[model samples]
Target: MVDKALNDLLTLWVTIEPIGTVVLFATLSAHLPQAQRRKVALKAVFYSTIILLGSIVVGQIILSAMQIRLISLQVAGGLILFLFALQMVFDFSHERPATPEKGHDISVFPLAVPSIAGAEAIMAVVLLTDNHVYSISSQFVTACVVVCIMSVTYGLMLLAEPILRIIGKNGAAILERVTGMILAALAVELIMEAIGVQRWIN
Candidate 1:
């Protein structure tokens, strides 16, 4: 049980990448007022948790109904995550506000969706809870791990301002780029695992 818990914790932590979320959150919300930043952070975390938990509950059913294989989902998710990482590393579009008037409600756009509850994170939860491999109780435990990781992510977002104060914008940008590289590596690993190379090696 301890081993399962630890494994789930580590898996969720890597897929969710809370530190990268914190850096991105800090970068995006730097221009907002303190109260607004807090509100956005809370909403983003709440929404992401709901989305991830919902995926854990219904993702398998949806996949089965669609006759989709977990391996296919893993590969597709890896491809999408790779594209997202490339955007993080090379795209400058994220630097522009959605609209000049009010700026985008980034809480929902990037923060909640791809930043916190990303495709990789969603696939991770579904894969972890797979009924064929994991017992119901073990799946429940994995769900709990997901919540714990999200809680840690929320705490990190709450500290974003202080972290940004120390790191500054340029430092945050560098960290984001490094995180993108890590994400790209993770994506490759996912694709390799989906194709059975990982199992062959083991």
Candidate 2:
């Protein structure tokens, strides 16, 4: 039981990538005041918690109704993650406007959906809490792990200003590219596992 919980913790940690989220939060919220930044972080966490926890509870059922296999979801998520990683590694949005558009609630769009609780993260929690593989009690444990990671992500986002101050723009850029590379590797592994290539290699 302890091993399972530990495994769940690690999987969620990697999929959630709190450090990467901190970089994103720092960059996106740089223009906002401290109070507004905190609110963005809080709202992001709130939205992420709802999305992740909801997936834990009913995600599989919805997938079943749609006849979507977990492996299919894994492959699709890997592709999406790979594309997003490419954007990060290449800094595709480097030429975009410095300021986010007015009336845009970033907390809901990029920050909440794809940054903090991304496609990979959503698929991961659902896989971890598979009804056939995990008991209700075990699923509850996984949900707790999700909340724990989200809490850590929120704390890191709260300290984004200080972290960015220490790291500076150059450091953040370097870290983002490095993280993109790591995420790309993980995405490949997810795809391989879903397609059973990993088992063949092993």
Candidate 3:
């Protein structure tokens, strides 16, 4: 159980990407007053919690309803995650928001949706809490882990300015690229496990 929880924590950390999110939050909220920035951070985390928790609860059911197999989703997610990792490693600039879109809530648009609770993150929660593979109690534990990760993200966002100043843009880019390499390896492991290659090798 401890091992599994640790694995879940690492997986959530990679997928939820608190460090990258902090940098993005700092950039996006740069113009806002401190009080407003706090509100935006809270809203982003709150919205992300709703989206991610919903995915944990009903994601597998929705997949089953669509006649999709977990293994299939796992493979697809692995591929997508790999591609995302490549983007992170090779071209970090693509993720940075241009000036906030007019009339759009930046908190919900880029921050909550893709920054905090991205497609990879959503797929990760669903895969981690698969109905067939994990018990209700296990799923509940995973949910708690998700909340913990989000709390960390929120905390980092709250400290974004200071953190960014300490790390500098180049440092953050280097860190993000290193994280991308780890994520790339994890993506390959997911594919191998989903395809039973790991079992065969074992």
Candidate 2 has a TM-score of 0.71
lDDT of 2 by residue, 9-108 (tens): 9999988888878877876665566788898899999999999999999998998899987678678767877886788799887654444568657787
Q: Which residue pairs collide, candidate 3?
A: none
Q: Pick the candidate with the highest TM-score.
A: 2
Which digits, one per residue and each the tens of the lDDT, describe model 3 over residues 70-185? 67856876787687677767874565553444666878856786667876788889989988799898998999999999898898899976765677667766766776686688
Weakest 10 consecutive residues of candidate 3 by summed lDDT = 92-101
Candidate 3 wrong stretches, greater than 4 Å: 66-103, 163-202
Locate the minimum summed-lDDT window of 10 residues in model 1: 95-104
Q: Model 2, which residues run further than 4 Å from truth?
A: 69-103, 166-202
Candidate 3 vs. truth: CA RMSD?
A: 5.8
**lDDT, residue 100, model 2:** 50
Better of 2 and 3 by lDDT: 2
Model 3 error, position 113 (Å)? 1.1
Q: How accurate locally is residue 31 in candidate 3, as Cα lDDT from 0 to 100?
A: 52
The runs of at least 3 residues in candidate 1 whose Cα sits more than 4 Å from the true structure, single-residue gaps closed, are 67-104, 167-202
Alpha carbon lDDT at 202, candidate 1: 91
Cα distance off (Å), candidate 2, residue 100: 5.5
